[model samples]
Target: MLSIRNLHASVDDTEILKGLSLEVGDGEVHAIMGVNGSGKSTLGHVLAGRPGYTETEGSVQMDGQDLLALEPEIRSREGLFLAFQYPVEVPGVTNLEFLKAAVEARANHRGEEPPNASEFLKQARALCDAVNLDQAFLRRGVNEGFSGGEKKRNELMQMMLLQPKVAILDETDSGLDIDALQVVADGVNGLRAPDRSFVVITHYQRLLNFIEPDYVHVLVGGRIVRSGDKSLALELEEKGYRWLEDEVA
Candidate 1:
């Protein structure tokens, strides 16, 4: 569903992703494992067209369309979703209001009218229940005064509602306790379909225990240095990235 070729990205004139290339097919789940400063999150942000990160060279295509050529909103309208590692807090916008606006914006992009408020609420409530989010959360301001786990749950809620074809979750496991992590994983798994895909970027394999990605990739020094199946993740956990250093050397 997504293909990135020789992706070279930089920030402030310093390169972070150096000629990284990977492909994710529809219905496939891929895990990107890397240590800090390894450019995992940068890959996610660059794919989502976040501001400030420049793509020095590369091409990102989704289902054969030029992904990098579109604006951020265009990316979202085209069924791409990015679950931020740290969800931003918008104090004045209620969660329900924010979601409705987003859902309507996407619908408008498709030449469809926005769902009425009653219908929108019904759909939003169903999504909240699926993600185990409290109804009260819908009435609260977005991420304001929410706990770390709460923020992650909110991100999943948005993903569920958006129903993107390809979802890039960057470090969704961070700061989440066991119960919260399970909830988030269940929510993601529930969204899996024959035409949907996921790129799960994480540091540890614990999240893999739940999501069970079809392919596991080791990203090091701003590039993917290894690719294998789930067993590779267990091996990495046991032998560590030190083995990768030797292999690369």
Candidate 2:
């Protein structure tokens, strides 16, 4: 569903993603594991077309469309979702209002009628339950005053609602406890389908223990150095990135 070839991206004139190439097929979950400064999060930001993360070389195509050429909003409308490592708070916009607008925007982008208020509210409430969030949260500002774990779950809530074709989760497990982690993982697993693909970025293998990616890749020095099945994640947990760095060096 997503294809990236020799992608070189830069932030503030310093190069990060150097000749990175990755292919995410339909129904595949690819986990990118790396140490600090390996550019795992950079890959997600670059893929989502975040401002200032310029793609200096290579190509990214999502479902055959030129992904890098589209604006971030256009990318979201085109079924590309990026769950940030640190979810920002919108103080005045209630969660329900934000999600409803997003869902309606997506529907309008697809030339479909937006869901009625009652149906949308019902679905939103159901998703709150699914993510272990309180129904009361629907009335609060987006991620406002939420704990780290709550913010993470809020990201998953958005992911579930958007149902993007390619979802890039940038360390969604960063601050989650074990129980909260499982809930988030369950939400992600429930959305897995033959038409969906995922790019999960993290520094630890514990997240993979829950999500169980189809492929595990070790990203170092701004590019993917090794790619394997889930067993690779286990190996990383046992040995850490030192072994991979030695191999790359």
lDDT of 2: 0.95
RMSD of candidate 1 to true structure, Å:
0.8
lDDT at residue 125 of model 2 (Cα atoms): 94
Tens digits of per-residue lDDT, candidate 2, 53-90, equal 99999999999999998988889999999999999999
Q: Score residue 127 of candidate 2 by CA lDDT.
A: 94
Off by over 4 Å in 1: none
| Local distance difference test, candidate 1 | 0.94
In candidate 2, stretches whose alpha carbon ends up further than 4 angstroms from where it belongs are: none
lDDT of candidates 1 onward, in order: 0.94, 0.95
User: Which digits, one per residue and each the tens of the lDDT, describe model 1 over residues 116-234?
Assistant: 99999999998888778888899999999999999999999999988999999999999999999999999999999989999999999999999999999999989999999999999
Q: What is the lDDT of residue 201 in candidate 1?
A: 99
Return the clash pairs for model 1, or none.
Answer: none
For model 2, the run of ten residues with the poorest summed lDDT: 46-55
Q: Least lDDT summed over 10 consecutive residues: which range in candidate 1?
A: 127-136
Clashes of 2: 0
Error of 2 at 56 (Å): 0.1
